[model samples]
Target: MDSEKPREIRIGNAERTTALEALGEHYTIGRLDNAEYSERVDAVTAARTRSELSELFIDLPEPTPFGPGDGSAALTPAARAASAPARIPDRREKVVRTLNLFAGGGTVLVFLLLLALGVPMAWLVFILLPMAYGAIRIWAGPGDVDASGIDSAEQQRRRDVESRRRKELGY
Candidate 1:
């Protein structure tokens, strides 16, 4: 009996790009050093077949361009979501968001009231200031810790205090 051989699939630029991105992640997490990363990147760029790209990641971990079945690219959606970092909004973020909502609504109401009362357009500045202030506060972010100015210990202390305050206030 004659057996049929599977065809070797050639990779495209998209596959090469995916391989580079995966290699970048591995390098960022310190899995590959500078020399090894450079070598793998060169190989990925020059690689023609899916098997060539797959071989580059054989020594590495998951999140590779090639999967177990037929060199399929990328993680499953569930796996991608699971790997992503969770960003839980803290108490200060919650407060800022709430205040922004109120500020926006109040600004609109005042603007309409001024317009109905035949006030000069210049008076709109008064309605706009609170909104501007809210925008600035939101842009500045949480005030509990100054990431650049504070030492690690002080920053930790501030975070602890903020956490305690949030717990006490039921936030």
Candidate 2:
């Protein structure tokens, strides 16, 4: 009856996707180099059985997609939050986004108004100014200063100082 032989379980798309994500995370963290990562990725895509997928992570550490009792599931919400790095919002990006929205909306409104007034098509060229300004701002990338001319570094420094003071005062 071949009772000693273990059943071969087949894997599906969901398992493949989870394995791929785990592999990607490992690659991102430098656990796998470009060539090794590419080879493993191709192997993962071709893997059809659970045993085949398990072979890919044999050299890696924990956090395998096929395994149960991974450490991440044991972390408390507060511990997880504390473990994550804090992100400081960039005011320059926000300002540029606002500028883009204003430019687009202004261009559409002006075009509609000019159309309603039966103005010549040549006047439509004026709408290009706001769009051009928006394009320039985007092309410039997130600069050091925001629309208010405030230096982002200075703002961040001031915020750090304030936070330190508050902590020192036990506030």
Candidate 3:
């Protein structure tokens, strides 16, 4: 009869429960510090989950030095990935077009008002008045952000909401 080498019995699921109970006892009796106890306990718990632990084997070092294989070529800066292009604004273009339409409409309305009020042809000069006023107001630059002018309550609420959104997104 041949006497062969004895095989080892791998620890099973029930053994895991006993191990955990022992680990908890060690913690409760002050045999280990909280941080060390938790780390060791987590390690044993992690060891029993086979399929989950299998992921830990990926690209693991084998106690030997290694580097990138010599066959592959490295890419230069100009050959790297490019960003997606920005689209130009159609919205602002339409706003300018609408402003032109508003100017023409204002002229027609002024002419009609003069005729209705029984004014003479010389009143046609009034047609340019609103357009000139609008040009001067626009060229004077944007108005000041005076606290007394605009209602501060709603503006404060909008700023708070924007700040909260930024914080929640972790930016």
Candidate 4:
């Protein structure tokens, strides 16, 4: 036996469970017989120290740790997207949004005003025209407004799928 002393730091339930799972894997692969597996499982359940847990894996390779080694990684993929400050819409997108608001609200205002003045209902189409454009602009999103919208990962994925489909169709 090696003379080096194992660390005896106290272990938690999660640590014990991890050790037991490792033992189960070894047994599943025939590294441990049924009797040996049962015995080790019992020992693992009773273990209280890191040294005890470490002893169970003395003959096995260490498993990889999950997540970042340091705790300071980006909070989300969106946050990691860019280090640049918040994106501001260009003049084109601003104009489009302004026009959109004006179209929708202006249509409603004019419609109410015309209705109050008792204008014929046939003239309502003039008010509805801008409102229809506003609805279309909203449905198409800012991408259509400025042609500068960033494609999301999901959008890229869908495009790739469509491209593959087109290739398969020989188009």
Q: Report backbone clashes per prediction.
A: 0, 0, 0, 0
Tens digits of per-residue lDDT for model 3 on 93-169?
44555566766676777778888888879465565666675675576545432222322453454445434533443
Worst 10 residues of 2 by lDDT: 162-171
Better of 2 and 4 by TM-score: 2
* TM-score, model 2 to reference: 0.40
What lDDT would candidate 2 get against the real structure?
Answer: 0.65
Model 2: lDDT of residue 20: 75
Off by over 4 Å in 1: 1-4, 68-171
- The TM-scores of all predictions, comma-separated, are 0.39, 0.40, 0.24, 0.32
TM-score, ranked from best to worst: 2, 1, 4, 3
Residue 108 lDDT in candidate 2: 73
CA lDDT, candidate 3, residue 98? 57
Task: Compose the digit string of candidate 4's lDDT tens values, residues 27-106.
Answer: 44344555876676666767787656556554443220112322214235454334222356766566677777777677
Q: Which ten residues in a row have the lowest lDDT in candidate 3?
A: 63-72
Candidate 2 local lDDT, 1-171, one digit each (tens)? 799998888988788778776776555444565588668877877889987888887656545777744334455667655543344547667667777786767677777787888888946546676767767787767677543334667556545543453344333
lDDT of 2 at 76: 64
